[model samples]
Target: MNSGEVIDVTRDAIVTFLKVGGPMLVVALLVGVAISLLQALTQIQEQTLVFVPKILALAAAALFAMPFMGDAMASYMTRIAERIAGG
Candidate 1:
């Protein structure tokens, strides 16, 4: 593929990746921040305390976002297939 097409595909792939992962990342970040604040207030410096909630938050976010992730990935793959077919 030419440089322009390669760049376009790369950009699309990155955008798709961010869209797919963004929700979970945001959830995890929020959970972490909240946990940190609670820990600060309670003076409980437990690493496990921070981790478990973050895990659960990320899991819930991933589950909630599964359909969106699938659709984004499918659309990206379809575009790739169309490009391949055209070439």
Candidate 2:
């Protein structure tokens, strides 16, 4: 593949990665922020308090998003295969 093809592939890979991972990251960020705010308001100040909730939120998000993520990755792989076969 040429430089342009390489760039295109790289860009697609990044987008695919974002699509697959964005939901969990967003969930984690939101959960962390909410936990931080709660802690600030209640004066809890417990450093370990955030881990369980964040992990649970991320797990739920991943479970909910799994089908969409799978479809996106499958389509990306299909595109890659088509490109390879075309060349």
Candidate 3:
């Protein structure tokens, strides 16, 4: 692939990755922020308290988003494969 093509492919790959991970990441971030606020207010500095909820929330988000992520990745792969074959 030429430089432009390579860049396009890389960009697409990154976009695909972000699309797949975005929901889970957002959930984790929101949960973390909320937990941080709660901890601050309560003055409870338990490490597990912060981590466990975020992890569980992220896991749940990932599970719920799995089908959509799979479809997006599959579409991206199909497009990339078609481009490669055409070239």
Candidate maximizing lDDT: 2
- Clashes in model 2: which pairs? none
lDDT of 2 by residue, 30-57 (tens): 9999999999999998999999999999
Assess every candidate by TM-score: 0.95, 0.96, 0.91
How much lDDT does each candidate structure score?
A: 0.91, 0.96, 0.91
Score residue 1 of candidate 2 by CA lDDT: 81
What is the number of residue pairs that collide in model 1?
A: 0
Candidate number with the higher TM-score (2 or 3): 2
Sorted on TM-score, highest at the top, how do the candidates line up?
A: 2, 1, 3
| Model 2 regions lying over 4 Å from their true place | none
